[model samples]
Target: MTTDQSSPISPYLTFDKKEWAKLRAETPMTLDARDLERLSGVIERVSEQEVIEVYLPLSRLLNFYVGASQALHAATSRFLGQSENKTPFIIGIAGSVAVGKSTTARVLQALLSRWTNSPRVDLVPTDGFLLPNAVLEERGIMNRKGFPESFDTRALLHFLAEVKAGRPQVKAPVYSHFHYDVLPDKTITVDRPDILIVEGLNLLQPAKLPSNGEAIPFVSDFFDFSIYIDADPELIGQWYVERFMRLRKTAFRDPAAYFYRYSKLSDDEAQATARHIWETINLANLKANILPTRQRARLILEKVQDHTVQTVHLRKI
Candidate 1:
């Protein structure tokens, strides 16, 4: 581990991939190729080597954090002279559109679940909280679909509040990628799990404060721990185009797909369309909203052009 030479008082301790891997320290690998295949995204690759090096140490660290949090909660309960309900440990994963937040969250959920105690872990994506297409169209902001404003932040907060309060059968709406919309009748029941992982593009976005110091609970206020996936914007753009092309061959070929119109485009046309969308929407969103919150994360996983994490900058205790 190393500290930034430029900022003598920097809050983070930096670790190269090799240095971070050493921290795995006897943490056994629990995932196979099949598990990786299931957890990864269209272009995101989660190899066994990544699991052994990057995620194992992260799992061990999170395990320790969870244990400590539980102990602290227990102590607080004791001080109050009563037993309190178990509060789920919530982790937030934030990054750009193609930054593989889902892959990372799913991998963590799997590893965390396989711990000796086998705690119940739930994974939820904020895509479910995205405003419906009709709503977006009505608001005349359909082009800003993944922007922070596109989300039903109030509903998201309510869901998190209920989950944190140990409510049973808390329902979160589901989003279908094929339809590119929130399913009206579909919901995921989150039953007071031991852990919940919330993944999104803007999970760490801060709320604007009032002059009178009013409490405005932002989405990240509910997170006990947070991670930011970092990579070059250019590389991410390339990956986005690559993923779009792949989807054109697969999902876009289905007539029911929201982006089915792009399926018939020639290679050049498809590439141009992908690039246009990336530049006009995704890239703009990243620069204005997502990238700004990178420093807010408890841990930052900086990825190389190849999409594997090359370094980790962890906020110090």
Candidate 2:
């Protein structure tokens, strides 16, 4: 992406490949991960090394918001209820799959924790609230995983409410990426923190189409701030397909892996299947649900094909 000279932001990103070199000067550092190379079977380059330069500024920016949110929370709590302690500031992060939102959330957690005023930033992924495989299978929606309807919405809302209400400790469900399912009997706890970040694909989606007149609240209502990672649909699809094909050659090869059955396919055939899944499942979900919620974000990080953030679109308050 090339910088828009007209735009106020420095090194404004535009749709030009040559601009990347010029914009590299604006980036601070890059994350180094040999592990990403080992894990990804399809990727030719481990540009996760780009993470530092790409996300460090983002983390610094988010730390500012986290502090502001906490200050606002304290003011509101005092104004409404004189003696009550304020809860942590909650930030919601939403984006389509393979857009790197998970990695973003983790990096934010690490960076936000380094802030002097707020050294504690807790991250919770909505994957934990996904319905068990049995339930999805029973409902014949096993193929619709990551869709808004596949989660335990009420339970997720309840957990967020408790966290917002200043509960000393809160427990959240946990999910396993390897198993591709929400784990049973395993949970993560959040002792009151300075900030809480909730990440998921459908986190910013509006409530389901109404049936009757009354509307039910969703977890996003608890967010003090929200972020949406923006990307072109074609780019996201390509990334997803690339990741899937890579995983097939590695993770799927593990005999005990849930997707092990698909590992036997030839590379060419596996790549074709990955593309098919992206078109039929992921791309459909992005259009039907996620893309529509971009307007809901307080800030949007727009990325290009090179896996670097090009522009940051912030909502005018």
Candidate 3:
């Protein structure tokens, strides 16, 4: 079911682009054209105006949140008579594929890092936690690549747990888009940071309660704040197809690329294949896992056909 952005009883305070832009107040725009171009996805478009209006306000809000959290930690440490250890403020960005979650995460990372309160902000994509292609194939779930069951959940949970515990250094497996798989030898080492942004398709998904009442930790358990990117599925599907077509002339042309075979296909054949994949795989994942978790986000950014955010829904505290 679609959310009622206009409902009086809604948990969120909805704001249109203009109303939301007013919230920016005095937050300065720190990103440039080169920064946006470098951080954007293959086919995603981000404008400086979007940053000034939408993201600056967001960075300002997060700066307040981080400051509050830090103060709270210091007070609690003093109360307990213990040395204070820095706990990273974890932010999660969840969305459907082709809905610009990566761009949002990267943009936020840049903005948050620029803030005096959160100069050290790290962004981690959950693609790295996905099961290796070999393991997925062995389990006969290769087609369900982005599904919750397709991830190394235990490993991801352990990493998050350690990070939240104020570990000095944590390592995450690295995945390669060109190879379309996790690299066995490569890992991204994350040092202690003031803020950590975790982005993924299923970050907000809740785990089923065990019949025996055993404790089960979900990925969302570590998130101090979460954002959901929302758009009509039809628009997302169109964007996915457009991105696929564009990849055919770029990334797919590299002989070392996993999708190189797709480069040889005609434009008509490529579009058909992209749509089929969307209908059978990506759309299914969105419906079954991603969309249902939208309300769990502390904030939701609703996008229009052109990929510009049209509405902002901030959950009432």
Candidate 4:
């Protein structure tokens, strides 16, 4: 005899995306508008009702999880009878490029910081861990930039180790989107944050040592919780093109922008360039690496082509 104990939870029983939209529309807007504006860097024009319905409950859920994680940590410390140390509650957010992981991380950091305990929340991106273009060229990996092998894995791992050990003034390298490169010697010192949200394309990667035979744990090993943003490939591709079109009129016009050449391109020319990048780089990385790691996430937020979340898939117990 065997037993089966797993099934979907939530009132979600429909395949239609409108179900969420309708539900969100019906819910009263309780979350303050100013609250959201201050919490998020990118003030996306999401409907007020959606926050009241969907995100408010989600925020409450995450708060509970964070509190539980802290309680568990304290219990472990008591068992060891060690001196009190504050280890930041680390969360890993993993998703494909252009899948809104950055947006999600920013929103969560802002909301979590405003909770009753009002812990200090810091958001960091793993793009800063990317090797310099010069270094990538030296290793002949300039073309395969966002792949797992392109990162300084050991350095990233060590940084997380020190942060988890509650070391004071832990510094992380900074990456600039305008420059499209890691800023040399510029570091963000994290001073004992109550929560650290690490957002990246490949944070859920599995550890694999070379045939040279060494064993090493992955960065995901340090995460107390992890979430994977999910969306269809076609939707992400469209969003990439749209975002590129928007940037063509904004950042691309800057003389120092890495994409300054795009500022001069016609609309069609810019779209073509964006398509080429999606096909050659971002999409390829998504299919080959990022999508596979969804299996490792503790929770998955599945989205529809309209970019609103449809349903959430929690890992089976």
Candidate that would win on TM-score? 1
Off by over 4 Å in 1: none
lDDT for each residue of candidate 3 in 112-210, tens digit (9 for 90 to 100) = 999888999988899999999999999999999999999998999999998899997799999898899999999888888999999999999999999
Give, for candidate 1, the lowest lDDT window spanning 10 residues.
1-10
- The TM-score of predicted model 1 comes to 0.98
**Candidate 3 regions with alpha-carbon error over 4 angstroms:** 1-8
How well does model 3 score by local distance difference test?
0.92
Q: List the residue pairs that clash in candidate 3.
A: none
Residue 263, candidate 2: C-alpha displacement in angstroms: 1.0
lDDT (tens digit, per residue) of candidate 1 on 1-317: 88845488889999999999999999999888899889888998889999998999999999998888888888999999986888898999999998888889999999999885437999999999999999999999999989999999999999999998889999999999999999999999999898999999989999888999989999898888999999999999999999999999999999999999999999999999999999999999999999999989999999988889999999998
Candidate 3 residue-wise lDDT at 205? 94
User: How well does candidate 1 match the true structure, expressed as C-alpha RMSD?
Assistant: 1.0
Best by lDDT: 1
Per-candidate TM-scores read 0.98, 0.83, 0.97, 0.87
How does model 4 score by TM-score?
0.87
Candidate order by lDDT, decreasing, is: 1, 3, 4, 2
**Residues 192-291, model 4: lDDT tens digits:** 8888999999999897777877877799999988989988999888888888888889888999999899999999999999999998998999999999
Instruction: Compose the digit string of candidate 2's lDDT tens values, residues 251-291.
Output: 88898888887799888888888888888888889999999
